[model samples]
Target: MFTSLRLPQPVIDQPSRLVLRLGLGGGLALAAAYGLAFAVPHVSLLMALLLLSKPGPALALGKGVVLAGVLMLLIGSGVLLVPLLENYAVAALLLIGLGLFAIFFIGTRQSHPLLSLLLVSFTLIPVAGVQGQALALQVVHALAGGVILGAVSGTLMHLLLPDLRQLPKAAPHKPGVEDAVWLAVRGVLIVLPVLLLALQNPALYMAAIMKTATLGQQAGSLNARDAGRELLGSTLLGAGLALLAWLGLSLWPSLWMYTLWITLALCWLGLRLYRILPTRHPPSFWLNAMITLVIFLGPAVQDSASGKDVLTAAVIRLALFTGVALYAWAAIYVLERVRLRFHPAGPRNGVSTC
Candidate 1:
């Protein structure tokens, strides 16, 4: 995408092209998905956006297709569980906890980076305000629609635009049962409390997002200090830009104008997000901040916002990701140290399980 301009030192550092690809592909996919008219357009596009973060193929082409199918079935199954537990709040919450545990456990493996999206999307099927067979159908269709569209668009993107970083493949390995269990424990520790907080709020307006952001970080990949600084800077800049664009729409006061405003805002935001991902870009939080806004504040992007509303949301989101980063780093650092002390010669595990 930057053929004329001399690429930076790590040619792969720039990913503005990827964001553009996501915007175009995600737009087309949303157009098709919205034809259903009853589906949540933002949900599908949001899924596509999350999937865009995942660079390589989805679980190997053939396996990914199978995995997608399995995910649909599992989503349907989750829908059934909701009604069965509606009369029992305890069971419902426990089910949610168990599901969170599983998502974290599987997510510990680098092989399944997108599993966090898959798991949360499926788990939420129960609470998607659906019931019975229709619930199953809707949940399956919703998730499948998004996942298929994302995968197709991603494939086309790879075919047309060469990957900025053609990092050579290394053999992927599965985490051991012990590693999975420990990771799940840490995730549950961090998530269960947050889940409880969300439950306390009647709307649960931001809980799922917070949980997803929290688990999105894997252990050992980025240090907490770097993650904190980057998150603070990026959230401040990106939120500033987003809130400003939001203010512009109130002046124009037309749907078309608002649409134009959103398109431009996303373009600018996408550039910032991509710039933040480059090697010089600090690790962690910028991308999470971007995604968090989409999931939480997307529907209102083109609408007028109260200064209080914007400020409150921004502060809450900044806190959410920052807390997640610190927790992730602490868990990794503490666990690794304990493991080393107990078995000083054991093979070192570099990955974080936060």
Candidate 2:
């Protein structure tokens, strides 16, 4: 339904090669997931886009996707072991620890393994005791579907358009293990208290997960101005966009209709997302907003009309964003002063080459 004339001028004039690949791949993955009734279709497009968005060889992308997919399955399945912690607080704390550790292994520099994507695949798991297995299985299946299809699409594009230009990338040095360890320590100290506190409030838990995942992504920049803007602006915009999707679907609900709607939205928003990027993997502002829309509003399209869930999610997201941003900025500010005051010996910058 996206006719040529309806597309934006930037899209028509200077279409991003990576964006085009992501859109085609995500759209196809979405169609397959919906058509086949995948367990967690909502994740299919997101995973596809995430994996395929990196500017690299198709084979390299495929390899990373496979590695990440296996990691996703392993991590998701590990949720089954959460009961071992006995205390819910202990479980949350352990999970936070696991998240921070992996966050280091993935490196916190300039987006090597991509911390945000890594969190969704491994870190943001729900510790629902026995049900954790089922949740994990669902996540793995959804991820598998996306990665497999997205990789295929990327490979195909590479074959067909060998001359296609890739996005410019910054080659930041890999962080030393000691630097990574220190960063992990900082991450745990900052995140553990918040994680425990968030666990106390069911409504606040998801927000905490979102906030922390975002924190990991922004760790490289430690730019409060950009991070705050991305967090607040994207979340508010995403919530509003989700409301629109819900309203539209509520009026004329149909399986095919909603599928088409989501597909188109993905394409349009994805293109927009790629166009606004100031760096190779800087904060994903509009994409985050679109994700917020899809994740929060997608369900309302099917559920009976009530503004309660959307409103609650919106508030939680905003509050947690504010809280997390404050902590991140405060931590960064103090760290800068310390480094300046006592020039500690380690990696000069926080970046990952992975």
Candidate 3:
């Protein structure tokens, strides 16, 4: 429940309030994550941005801590599969698939955005563990830290720029059982290939897992017609944004500059996301683009720090991301056609299927 604070009416009435909250809050989280030198600092930054994108009030500190603990517990649980993965690969893969479907089904039925986070942890932690248990533990720690960072940044933003008038929150749309099942299936198909690929080289495909997990969750909300544009288009837009940001950072390579650049990018996207900038695209489009931007840029930064060829690495990553998006688009098209053939009638209760 968001309550209005004693703030000026101008700030309350202007849509820029939400944009500012998203931009500033995200920037603060990014700065803190990198400043403290957390493992996979970009993960923390991405989590914070996602949290800030939610329309309602920030989670209380206590709840935030609890969420962090839950994230650690859930992600850390993946370590249990390491032995199975090494010993009984077939059974382990099947188990992971089942778990992914269950999580996607629950999230789709409930219309929860945190599904992306859960999906990432579920898919990423186990795969990373296959490479090494230490890497898996690091992934868990990074995600938990990200949750805490998100909570703190969200709370601070709310306090500093409280929404003086509470807007009516839209009731979440819950799909029918059949729709939920189909959507969850689509979500699984979108991620499963990438998950399998990541199992080969978890170190390189870690970011891909993150991107695919987001795509899987996003696919649930998209129709077949819009799947290509929303999925592939956003990936390209994000890649472009990351390229530009990397160029800007090159001009003045400093943490302060990096923070500023990221903040500016977030603000620009926030304008579109909050509808301050007119656009035909939905808010999810911009949100995905923002996530894409971070996903692309984070790895580039790591590559540069590790003395790798940034341009070549970025190009390769872009290609991989594009391939994943194209696959997601195709999966949606094929699945929707199959669903239509069987049912003849489309989704009931006005629920759209992918």
**Top candidate by lDDT:** 3
Could you tell me the lDDT of residue 188 within candidate 3?
87
Give lDDT tens digits, candidate 1, residues 26-76.
Answer: 555555555444255455555665666554543344554665687677666
Per-residue alpha-carbon lDDT of candidate 2 for residues 187-271, written as tens digits (9 for 90 to 100): 5555555655554553445445545554554454444335456555666666676666656666786665565556566666666
TM-score to native of every candidate shown: 0.65, 0.71, 0.93
How far residue 311's Cα lies from its native spot in candidate 1, in Å, is 9.3
lDDT score at residue 111, model 1, on the 0-100 scale: 46
Candidate 3 residue spans exceeding 4 A from truth: 1-14, 348-354
The C-alpha local distance difference test score for the whole of candidate 2 amounts to 0.57
State the weakest 10-residue window (summed lDDT) of model 3: 345-354
> Which of 2 and 3 is ahead in lDDT?
3
lDDT of 3 by residue, 183-294 (tens): 7788888898899999998877888888898888778778778889999999999999898899999999878888888999999998999898889877877988999999
**Candidate 1, which segments miss by more than 4 Å at Cα?**
1-19, 30-38, 57-69, 129-140, 156-167, 170-180, 200-202, 206-227, 230-238, 248-284, 301-354
Error of 1 at 352 (Å): 5.9
**lDDT measured at residue 250 in model 1 versus the true structure, 0 to 100:** 63
| Candidates, ranked, TM-score | 3, 2, 1
Sequence-dependent TM-score of model 3: 0.93
Better of 2 and 3 by TM-score: 3
Pull out the clashing pairs in model 1.
219-352, 220-352
